[model samples]
Target chain A: MSIQIWTFILVGITFAIYLSIAWMSRVRDTRGFYVAGGGVPALANGMATAADWMSAASFISMAGLISFMGYTGCVYLMGWTGGYVLLALLLAPYLRKFGKFTVPDFVGDRYYSDGARVVALVCAIFASLTYVAGQMRGVGIVFSRFLEVDVNTGVIIGMIIVFIYAGLGGMKGITWTQVAQYCVLILAFLIPAVAISIKITGHFIPQIGFGGVISEGANAGRYLLDTLNAISADLGFDQYTQAFGPNSKSMLDVAAITLALMVGTAGLPHVIIRFYTVPSVKAARLSAGYALLFIAILYTTAPSVAVFARYNMIDTLNNVAYEQAPSWFKNWEKTGLIAWVDKNGDGKMEYRAGKAIEGKPKLTGQTGIYGQALVSNKVVDSNANELYVDRDIMVLANPEIADLPAWVIALVAAGGLAAALSTASGLLLVIASSISHDLYYRIINRSASEKQRLLLGRIMIGVAVCAAGYFGINPPGFVAQVVAFAFGLAASSFFPILVLGIFWKRASKEGAITGMVLGIGFTMLYIIQTKFLGVGNWFFGISPEGIGTVGMILNFAATVLVSLVTKAPPQDIQDMVESIRTPRGAGLATDH
Target chain B: MENQDRLKEYWRRNLRLMLVLLAIWAVVSYGFSIVFVQALNKIHLGGFPLGFWFAQQGSIYTFVGLIFVYVWRMRRLDREYDVHE
Candidate 1:
């Protein structure tokens, strides 16, 4: 069977499963919609959180990016996972004890100000919407690549599927579907990884395969990482096993990026909200641990897959004739993700160091003399590096690159859609509830009844889905530019305030407002200056990507300093913090 | 007043435990993984350099363990303070 047909069947089956789960778990009341009635089991909540946290980026792009980044990839691997430690210890339990519906709810009530809530609501919306747009774009790309549909059609299909389950079931529906998604994506990711691992190193466990010696070919008896290093060095590229390789980011910058991502993960409103669905503080704690465990299943495997995929691509494609290039090469070439410019016009493809084209390949809908796609971009004046591979293709084309079955390739398509849709729904709920629960119900219509609130929440979900889909289809160029900064903004604005609100009794609304404004404000200024305006890195050589670390530090310092000068929070609010400190008497999340 | 004293003590104990655990977390990730990585990489863990393993793989597993340990210790602390729910 063709990969396309198999994709249709697998994707069709997965869609059916998600829609059915949504139907069965359909929610009507606002509590059910917002926090799944606060009765979810810890293990299931863990699974849901994993699905919610692992977006299209995690499934489709991380390994690809890591493959090229080599040992420097630890920034993402550790940065993303370490945040759960902060979440489990410093955030989740207290937030659960406080029993709030949104991060804004906790912020507003704890700070004793509606103004603080509004600020938090805006930040939550800004960050979640930016992240959701990327997920929708990912959905569209996956559909276009696998289902053979146009990108916009694929996006519409994705939006419709999301509307069915997400609009119908809300959090209740979304949670169950995410459990199913976590299963599909993990299996899809693992099966190919395990298969390729055995083929290359005779090891079934990818973590073991990571260091396992190559079992075949001339490189047999060599460690996989060692083999990759030799090949990369031979190509005038940095060794894969070495840190701070010639092309790698500075260690200080890598540490800063990792710290930003770590705190940013903990502060994300969508991820934190998942803890509220569990029944107790204990459940919240357990669920967080389980969440990390489930996420680690994929996170640990990714580096190994990076090693195998990197080794295979270079080994097969280098010095091969263009016409006789591997089938995966030709297939991915048509998609315009991997281009061969044949700079020397020798009819041979050379995979070496340096850029082949001046910039990204622009297809003119023309074929070259060797029947390869003609790139309109100018060939760079450098070495015989004739290939340009998109980072996204590393995971997407892995099955084909390793000659896995058509079914496995189709399974990957299903898995990619599951990842994108689950994250989109989770982020949509945050945007919807931020507007409906926080803005409309709390501020605009305090006298509104349950039915009105529920209706507004559902309507807001519809609006958010459309908004996300629109941005997905016509992503403002800044959508991509601003996406990385979502974490920075979250780290700078949200993390400090939330932490201070819980741990420090004297933290005031004035202090939180000041902290958020100064922290996020400075971070944004630095990013716009360096990233957009091309200002030189003025802060100790830290790029905009790592400036969030500085922003986070400034937030903590400013919040504390402002609090010291300001009046202490009332004794009642201090007592509230004391109560949130313990695990006893936690209950269902409430708006009040 | 007596109940208040107990709550304060429980909170104090919790803070101390958290401090100890977060310290380990920082040492493994920031200490061994980043700051002292060059020194640690000289030591090998089978096929992996120790620092690289800590940075990428080991830190994640330790994070999971830390959360569970917090859960277990906090559970006992809850019982000790008669605050178990």
Candidate 2:
């Protein structure tokens, strides 16, 4: 009857489904292991791509981030979704025609250089590892809350689950599991959002309800955005719909960040790899459309959920005594992610614009006078703010804040796990494939048998999972910063080269290798300088988050310039480029 | 030689179509959503400010539409060039 029980039931059921799919789909050959025999339906591949693309960040974090950020959060919404257009138009279909097992395969063959293949795979591994670490942490957070386990134990459990499917079935297993995950995660996101929408605005459609007038609140009869704007301003925060507010990002930064993410999304190895599962060039194009449509359902609803979460947070928390606070607040507080300091000694929590405590909540593992979590953080001398809620709590605690059913809360837990686990397996598969397929077989053993390749692939997955799990528990200082730059890295590293390889016939091995090294190098150096050395915003006032666009530009320039000066590619290679331009004669994903 | 010319013409048409679509993509996302957001926010679409809606919702819808459109047009282009699989 309780939320915890419901979480166990839902998560147990979903995990059973995933493990069974993995068992049934296990493959013996390198082609089937890597590309699911290149026979997945467009509709199914679309669902898998949706699940793969929307990681822990999209499911658990984006809505909360948007809640805190207001309109400027558009950088993520547009940046992430817009990349599918580039993928559908410029990348996916042609790559499908090239018909290889990995992005590195295309790079190696097209550029006619093993060096280019190694460079691209290295970038792919680096970016994916950073992204997977974030997912493992998301899994840890969900399990820590619902299963009552420690974060490290939750990560170990997640690593084991991912290893089973990814190690055994490889891409064949991951694709099917992701399809199920897409369904579970999307439903989990929508049910709470739709219910909260109906409660507040009496509108079932969240997007339209977002504009509907509040139904039964103090701000009743006023439009939802207007009401949120009033609440935000009254709390000394910017208006809810305030575009480019003073506390928010500048216009150029928003644009640059969006461009980086869009380009980066298309370039991400895991996402592009999903196209290989499908049957044809046309399926690849159509699947991208379906992927975006499915992704849009969650993306559009996120902003609406952001509004409702902020509105409900203010309605339930501010001015309520700590003992009188909603049960969810008390429960979340035990996790130490949500804390309150009674600045005025009134025993009440006040949600305001300024910091509630210095630095972050330092839990003393003891209860305060009012039974609130006792944190050692010094109360800020500046303001009356008394709440220090982690932004992540916005989505997880939304149902509880609005008094939704326990089943929905449990569904949220399962959904978050589904999101985190699905993407982690996808990334792990890529890492394993890079080693077994690219590094070992292609580079080291051209005569390796299918059995040997499959064995190596399965073994590398276990290693990747352990490495990812360790990083999840002891996340590096750069975990959050590196994620943004991972996108920049992908943008700088892969997008330009892949596009040039397809569209430009003259692109040589020398040109691709040089562009890849310099472009990725420039982006990496900028990220390190700004993120690590604290040298902030040196290039045209763009921060590390937006520097990928500059890196991409440099890559395009370098590739084109170098290619023009160098000898043209061989005549046969030129004809190969011309041949891939047509959609006919698509091959199953395999090496020659 | 004739086949080469047809291939060139097909590639040219594809490039031309892509240019048009990408231009729309840039205009909506960069031009309206980012650069001219403030000006557009003065206009409202239902409950959402026009630019904010584009940033949050409209651009995503347009992206989905653009992809399907490309699929349909490209499929036809393939047929026209006798290149359909």
Candidate 3:
């Protein structure tokens, strides 16, 4: 069957499964709606957390990033999965013990300050919304390519589906839905890796295949890394396996970034909420262990995919004539996802980095441009600017370039959609919960009935869906770029406060408020200045890496200094901290 | 009185264990991969660079191993503390 038809069938099957799961597990009350009656199994909850954690970026962009970046791409793999260890060990169990409905609830009550809760609430919503916008865009991209629809229409459709499910079922529905999503996304990622491994190395396991030297015809035992590094250097890029940037980042910077991500991942409200679904504190802890295991499956395989794709691309096209390029090349070319132009009119695509050559125009009444129709419908200026390097193209173009069957290609399309939708649903539930449970019932209308709260939750979801759709339609910025901002904000604001509130008995309301504000505020000021004001050099030499680290350091310093300046919290708040720390109080709420 | 002694002993022991395991986790991940990668690159494992191994696989294996150990030891500690379900 054609790839399009197969994509339809696979996507159809996935949607049917989600709708069925959502239908069967409808929420009954506010408690059930918010936390699934707090009775989900630990292992199942872990799997769902994995699904929620691995968003569209993980499935679609991460491997693709590694494909071109080679060894340096290890940063994403190590940073992301390593963060989970920090989460499971340090944060999840204590938060579960806190027994709160939302992250803000923990902060507000722990500090005995509504102001602190509002700060956390602002941070959570900002992080969640930025993350959700990226997912919406991811869904739209996959749907546009596979389902043959406009990107915006696909976005609206995805938003509607999430609205119906997340609005109706809340966290209960989201957890089960995420489990299904994890299965589909993992299968989709692994199948291609396995197929390509067998094709290239005569092995099924990608990691083993990666180490096994290339066994294909005419390239037997070729070292992939050596070949890729040579190709990259040929194209005016850094050697693929070697680090190219500044040879020095302070140990402090490294520690700060790692700590920020580690704390940030654990601090993410969407991820923390998953633990609340489990039955007991022990289960909550165990669930985090399981989530890491599931995430590890993808984390380990991703580097192999990156290395293999890089080696294969260089080998397949080296010195080959342009007109005879594979169908996948032409297909991606049409989408403007990948582009190449022949210089010197040599009837061959020269994939190299060199200075521009002035030449005649290809099509013009009067022109003096380096222009020629060098290959089949491919034009080149005598002086091409540079090779196009959009990172999103890597995964979508992987299957076709590797000559995989139409079915695998279709499955990948569905997989990307699954990753996007699953995470979006999880976030939407949080957004719904924040409104229905925290804002409306707790703050705004304390006496509102459960039925009214549920209705309000659904209404809030509709509003959230519309907002997400608008961003997806006109994506404000880069997918990976926007995601980093969310992480930065979270790392700065929520992580420090949460850690202090849980671990330090003396952390007062003033300390929590000051830390969160400085963390988020400093990071925002740096980002705004760097991106808009173009005065990146002016701000403590702050680039993306430096800004997050600086923000985190400032957060720590402010919290400590402010806490020392302010009086220790009241007797009851001090007791609350002690109770949360003790294992005996596991069944009771922190305040009680 | 015996139970109280056992619980205090358990908390003291578990705290020590958690600190040790956390050290190992930090060393393998941040220490090896970020701080000491260049130094460790002089040593190789199975023809693969040691630093690359830690970045890609070794660190993850360490994390998983640490968690399982934590769970197993924590379960034992819970029994000692009379906190086991």
Which structure among the candidates has the greatest DockQ? Answer: 2
> Lowest summed-lDDT stretch of 10 residues in model 2 chain A?
A583-592
**lDDT at position A429, candidate 3:** 72
DockQ of each: 0.73, 0.82, 0.48
DockQ of 3: 0.48
lDDT by residue for model 3 (A312-415), tens: 65566545566576666667655545545544545555555433232322223221123222223234354443234345666777787667889899989888
Q: Is candidate 2 or candidate 3 better by DockQ?
A: 2
Go through the candidates in order and give the C-alpha RMSD of each one to the true structure.
1.3, 1.3, 4.0
> What's the TM-score of each model vs. the native?
0.98, 0.98, 0.91
On a 0 to 100 scale, what is the lDDT of residue A206 in model 2? Answer: 90
Residue A441, model 3: lDDT of 70
Rank order (by DockQ, best first): 2, 1, 3
Q: RMSD in angstroms, candidate 2? A: 1.3
DockQ of 1: 0.73
| lDDT tens digits, residue span A443-486, model 1 | 88899999988888888999999999999999988876786688
- The reply for model 2, stretches above 4 Å from the true place, is none
| Deviation of model 1 at A36, angstroms | 0.6
Lowest-sum lDDT 10-residue window in model 3 chain A: A366-375
